[model samples]
Target: MNQHKKGLVVWIGIVLLLLAGALLAGPGDRVETVQETMRDAVLHNVNRISLLGLKEVNPGLISAFLVTIILLIAAALIRIFAVPRFRYIPGKLQLLLEQAVGLFDNMARGASPHRFRFVGAYIFAAGAFIFVGTLFELLGIQVVTVGGHPITLPAPLSDVNAAIALGTLSYLVILSGGVAANGVKGVGKTLKEFSLPISMSFRLFGALLSGLLVTELVYYYVNLSFVLPVVVGVLFTLLHAVIQTYVLTMLTSMYYGEVSEPSPPKPKKKKQASSPAEHA
Candidate 1:
């Protein structure tokens, strides 16, 4: 009706036309499926660890261990170097560290208002791991396998076993909070969930793996590779990193609150009133 409305209508028609053209475009020579994307990687058995008569360990286990070590060393460096230099007037690094810590601390306090003391550090540690480990893969760091093939190390949570380990550890932290606040009753109550570890594990694994698979698909197809995979892959990784970090921390704190909260006492029934005639 108006000039502005006409412009909007023109834009919508242009977008729809582009979509139709793209859909009608003939199939490319290369085809990709989820299974093919997943199976093409040399992920699991690449660099097997053989130690002391043991059969062999998975490469993902090694990645998890390496990530843990890196986290520990970084923490130690910050404590030794950064803590000594902290001043009243905070700079960029100091401000960032304090803010990051404060965010999780606030989440912990908000979720478990009464029992944050027990789970604050646990939540912080888990959040840091998920956030940092996801980003670590973007470095494109490669490790050579025993079989002489080089493969980029994936985020530990990308591996099912490592995801299971991470989930189990978080569940244990929650269980410990319950036990601390409610005694033996806490452990039983936490265990009642029974499937928390498995659910957490698969949720994390699925999210990370889907991102990995999509990125792989983009790279696998030559037509889609130019400049697009970097954008798509980075976006997916960053989204999963932030999302999974928040999800796990939120769930851990919420469950800890449920398990640690003191059970409310039942109200007693009111006494029946006696009539004057009955009393006489």
Candidate 2:
């Protein structure tokens, strides 16, 4: 079945990503002589490697920040115009976004109406993931300006860890909300909701992360070995964009449907009537 195949592919991708992250970020993966010499001359002051520390001295961090801002603005525009209205889709961008929105709406209808509120959060989280991925790639390109040297990024958390954390938390919230909204009757159904978000979010994060890591790994190994970087880079970036958009909108609709369920109506307020004499 298609669903089974999809699940298999996702799990395989997750495994590959874990291996890649461990290979690249493990304790023994220290900078070699060339990288150390370059850093010594250009970035000797860089002592610590925390997120905040990197941001203060690294141009890549500034670039990442700017790119994040741009992504947020684009996401805002998409949310405001494209998503809610379901407007026309002529260009490739609009067409792509329309497909994602359609999938998300289907998910929303299946979840609770109140859960629909979480569409915004999913959009934000997904967009953030994509922006981060693209920013890393762009920074890699920028490193070429300095004599085609390799540049390292300040990895916030391992891809596997992030995937697990993001997926588990998102699912728990969705499952809990759906269960509470449906009262005690649909406990089983609500419990089932947990896996959907978890799997969806994890699959997406793993795919994107794997794409990024693979690109960097390939470039590292085959920079001038007749392995065309442009083609490979473009391919991975394209895949990343498409996958991120799909995941973002799909999760949004899933959460939206969960939270969008209508609550039971309360008794109408009895408006005090005017005196009968005044009416007569």
Candidate 3:
């Protein structure tokens, strides 16, 4: 009972200290209004980046590139140093890799048994990209804009263009699976759901953008900025990362399954017996 009371008192003291600090800290210089801050968060034009002698590129594109490079490097390193060390008994790394691969493989097989191999590989790559890209924002990697303003690179999906490209790519994969399985019928089937790419693109964009906007809002205010931003930002980012990854992969697998389903063989027509009268 005494230990519990002591712990409670410690928490109370910490809270009081935080409150005092917040009170003592004066309001920060208001360089931008809340509206302006939010607007900047939503619009990439405000803080355009430069890449390959090109100006006005979105910062999210840089984030995407960085994430891609990171993944590639990690893949190469693992292939070089990790795969050869694997044992039949399975260590932590091997077990983790197996589980991750198995998850998408199982999902794909369950959804599209006829063509799970490609679907599994595609969704695994897509899921990894989405999951890693979303969490990349948490690293708070800052890049200088073309205008010399330093801004933190946002999640790739937070940019509509990245999200749209991914959605379109996933749709194309599904369409290809359909074409491979059912030919023209598959194309027609996939075409009928043309709005899928748009919906998927916006879904990813909106979810990631919401987290970005909220984090920006929290960080904009000086008083609320102390500890709240960390909690809000991490919770929102992690939640969105896991949720969006699962949602996209699951949807892709399900749709691919639907489109790639093999057509039932046409029933054989029963031949009518030759007319007995004509035969006679």
In terms of TM-score, which candidate is strongest? 3
- Model 2, span 1-280: residue lDDT tens: 9999999999999967766775665344445544443443233234222345333334334334555666679889988876676645466677876555555554554543455545545654555555464545544433321333444542221244444555666566555555666655335555656567557656755565565555545544532223345555666676666666656555645664544354567899999999999899
Clashing pairs in 3: none
- Measured over all alpha carbons after superposition, the RMSD of each candidate to the real structure, in angstroms, is 8.8, 14.7, 3.0
Where does candidate 1 have its weakest 10-residue lDDT segment?
Answer: 44-53
User: Can you give the lDDT of residue 17 in candidate 1?
Assistant: 75
Poorest 10 consecutive residues by lDDT, candidate 2: 41-50
**Tens-place lDDT digits, model 3, residues 81-146:** 999999999999999999989999999999998999999999999999999999999999989888
Model 1 per-residue lDDT tens digits across residues 9-43? 99999967765665566445543354644674425
Ranking by lDDT: 3, 1, 2
Count of backbone collisions in candidate 2: 20
TM-score of every candidate relative to the true structure: 0.77, 0.48, 0.89
For each predicted model, how many residue pairs clash, with residues at least 3 apart or on different chains?
A: 0, 20, 0
The runs of at least 3 residues in candidate 2 whose Cα sits more than 4 Å from the true structure, single-residue gaps closed, are 1-48, 53-115, 124-128, 131-136, 139-150, 154-158, 184-188, 193-198, 223-227, 255-280
lDDT of each: 0.79, 0.53, 0.90
Better of 2 and 3 by lDDT: 3
Give the number of the best model, judged by lDDT. 3
